[model samples]
Target: MALPSRASGGRPSARATDTALTLVVTAVVVAWTVVAMQYEDEPLSSTLVGWALIGVGCGALHFRRRHPVAVAVVTLAVSTVYYPLSAYDGPLMVTFALALYTASAEGRFTAAVALGVITLLAVGFGEAHQTGGNRQIDDTSLFMLAGWLISLVAIGRAQRTRTAYLHEVEQRALAAEREQEARARESATEERLRIARELHDVLGHSISLINVQSSAALHKLGKKPEPSAALTTAEEALEAVKATSKDALRELRATLGVLRQADEAAPTAPTSGLDRLDELVERARSTGIEVRTRTEGTPRPLPPPLDLAAYRIVQESLTNVTRHAQAQSALVTIAFTDADIRVRIDDDGRGSADEQAVGSGIRGMAERAKAFGGELTAENTADGFRVSARLPLTTIGGTQG
Candidate 1:
């Protein structure tokens, strides 16, 4: 984000500006010294010495950034000597003022102030006496010089303070950007894990059934030949495998589509939301488990991700009920409040809570609810086992359902 130096325009380069400033001050001081000398009865040698002193003082400014206080002292000493010895007056104080400004701007405020005070005192003393009838300074000029010096110091200090403030603001902006990027990376990592869990829940159940059915068919074929019965068993197993594999492929495609970039293509299949609750119920019913579902409040639209989470939690709970709970019938109740949606599945099964508590399906269900800033718990009730979940509506834009 740092800009190129050339972007600041031609003369903003500090070294180049300093060099130019030295040239200008040299010209101005030489001109003033020449004009003043024309009115005085001073010797040619004295004029040469005055010009040499101006060159030395103005030349020192080039190193002001590196040695501001030293440069200021050198310029001050040159001006103090040049005014008294020379039989003419010049604007030599220009070089000294520039040095004082540089010193204050470079964070040498105390030294610049002390030097300014010393120069003012020297001028005050010079005003009370004459330097070889030259009358180099007076009371009015001393006050004016003091005011100019104070203004230069103030301007330089203000510049330094402004620069410091700007630097602090830029640093804070960079820190905020870095923090935001870290949060984005963490969010991406969490999303990948959630997708992996969804894939497992989608394909695990049907694949397990295929494994069981195929194993049974193999065991039956190993028995003494009974042609018609064996053929019927083999046909049913193959059919079941075909249906299961087809469902797995469909869900797999849907899950994988979520990973694709936005510009490529969108998913062709619909996302699984609470609208597909009937399909889930039918699938569970085919497993010979009577599942009765009822909604306790008004059914409305919900955020797609939230809806999918709710559906997944219910689907996983029913999966556990059918797989582990040897219950005759189960009831799935969905009650909606203004703040959240609650899902409770109760089954009259003899399944032990301690055994089923450690299952991955339960953990996945809990994770799904938690993704929506909600909670889930599976415990045994008086009659049977119960799986409960509460999915919040406030987060991810309070969409009601």
Candidate 2:
């Protein structure tokens, strides 16, 4: 299996700096060893042995980041031995510095505290023994130990701060990504609903017109001596379909265009309703289907959505009869009562009484009716198919039934 890739958009890995740091550390150790060797008042062999042990301790520095605690322990052990053998000086101090850095980076607080106390005690004990309890201890060892402890604490604090900062950044980035996804999904759902509404509005009217006009054209073709007038009526129906299609397309583009531009003007055209039903029927009659309309009860004003729902139920029922019922005549009935508005469309045609699964047209009409706190039912009778829808007349704010 392949290795997993590293995360994007952060500092380079610690491994990236390994080679440079190792070379720099090696150079520093070698330079300090050479200076220490120059001041030695001993045989070359003894001095060479001492420098070799220091070199080994410095070489261990390369592994500090990968295993900081282990490197610190090894370096401390080597330094303890070197200090007693040779007087505490440059090479030993360099090893101690490396150990201090390792301990700060990786060792626990308890380990650092223990190391600090032991180092100070060792220095004090060595000083006391050399002076035979008569001379004052030098301040240099205390200062060195103090500096090493401070460096360890500073490195640990810096590491903690860096970790907290990185965690905060990651959380903010994750939240931003989730917010963007939610907005995108909401926008998509709105666009889909808008398109559905527009299609229902535009096509519903035109299809109703085509059904009425086509039946008229067929009837007129059978009675007239010449077929030209019948042909003209058919042509007019087709033209109306084309015109309605174009209008629907225009409205769809308008709504979707607003969504595409972040700073576009708000939409202007509101949804259509039942007041336009006369023009809808006239357009159908122009196409040749014979459409008869009847209205009963008081013509009380209704909410926009319920009105639109009532109009659509009639419209879809007529369109279905024309398309699949093989019907020449259709009837539309509207009744307004105290509590609800009722709509019924009936047609006398072959195959109208057959029961089949509901198609998208019927489903769309049902959805419109149900959206307004209403219900719809379609059934076949002895003579033809009948569609009835009941919508509550009561107004409910912000509800689109």
Best by lDDT: 1
TM-scores of the models, in the given order?
0.69, 0.69
lDDT of 2 by residue, 19-49 (tens): 5666676687678766765776665666666
Error of 2 at 265 (Å): 6.9
Q: Output candidate 2 Cα RMSD.
A: 5.7
Off by over 4 Å in 2: 1-12, 43-46, 91-114, 117-144, 189-193, 200-224, 227-270, 284-318, 325-359, 362-401
lDDT of each: 0.79, 0.65
Q: Which residue window of length 10 is worst by lDDT in model 1?
A: 1-10
Name the runs in model 1 displaced over 4 angstroms. Answer: 1-98, 108-111, 131-133, 137-151, 212-225, 282-303, 321-331, 335-340, 347-361, 381-384, 392-401
The per-candidate count of clashes, in order, stands at: 0, 12
Give the lDDT of residue 157 in candidate 1. 86
lDDT of 1 by residue, 1-401 (tens): 21212325444687778888888888888888778767887777887888788888989988877788999999999998888778877888788999999888877888989998998887777666665766656667777888988998998888777766777887899999999999899877777777778887787666654665577678878895589998987897787677767766877788888678989787788887888888777666645578999999988788887888888878777777766777778999988889999999999888888766656488877877876789999999899999999998997532211
